[model samples]
Target: MEWKLLATVFASVFIAEMADKTQLVTMLFAADRDVSRWTVFLGAAAALVLTSAIGVAAGAVLSEVINPRIMSLLAGSGFIVIGAWVLWQAIHGGA
Candidate 1:
């Protein structure tokens, strides 16, 4: 277990999830449902974990086919595009 890799995963996931829709949906679901909060929380967390695992596995396979540097560049550019879109929406008040 590389601590650095683990730390990177933790930090990236935390930052990505902080403003994610899944988190918001989870909060809304928990608020609206009559179910136990702990159950909802666990369910949401498990779903997120499974989704992340899928993403990681896909990335790993992609890395084997593509240059890692190229992958990093593409991923970074994608994040930039997403951030810009969010900023645009915030400024324009979603049209």
Candidate 2:
């Protein structure tokens, strides 16, 4: 197994998720009087795990059918496009 790769992914995702909406939603859930904090944590963790699993599985399948270089370019372009859209929306007060 690639320990370094695992660590890199974990760190990258952990940092990225620090201020993510999912974390904020989990916090909001935990703050409710009727909701248990541990339950919220567990539910959020499970959801993240499941989503991550799906991403990994999809990536594995894609890797088999697509060239990694092309995949990387596509992914990068997707992020750039999304970022630009968000920026445009923010500038236009479109939210």
Candidate 3:
């Protein structure tokens, strides 16, 4: 295993997940008095693992068909377009 690649991916994902909806939802679950903290941790961790697995599988299959450069461009463009749309909505008061 490439330690550098592992560290890069781990750091990227850790930062990206910070304060995201998943974290928020996990917090909510943990806040509930009746729920076990262990259950919340396990459930949230399993869900994240499952989603990451899906992403890796999808990327593996897509790489067989699409060039990595094109994929990166498309992903970056998609994020830009999404950000712009959200900004436009905010400026327009969602009207």
Give the whole-model CA lDDT for all candidates, comma-separated: 0.91, 0.94, 0.97
Q: Write the per-residue lDDT of candidate 3 for residues 1-95, one digit (tens) a residue.
A: 99999999999999999999999999999999999999999999999999999999999999999999999999999999999999999999993
| Winning candidate number (lDDT) | 3
Please list the residue runs of candidate 3 whose C-alpha ends up more than 4 Å from where it truly belongs after superposition: none
Worst 10 residues of 3 by lDDT: 86-95
| Residue pairs with backbone atoms closer than 3 Å in model 1 (clashes) | none
Off by over 4 Å in 2: none
Kindly list the per-residue Cα lDDT of model 2 for residues 6-74, writing each as its tens digit.
999999899989988998988889889997888998999999999999999999999999998999999
Q: What is the lDDT, from 0 to 100, of the residue 59 in candidate 1?
A: 89
Clashes of each: 0, 0, 0
Best by TM-score: 3
Candidate 3 vs. true structure, TM-score: 0.92
Q: How big is the positional error of residue 6 in model 2, measured in Å on the Cα after superposition?
A: 1.7
TM-score of each: 0.80, 0.87, 0.92
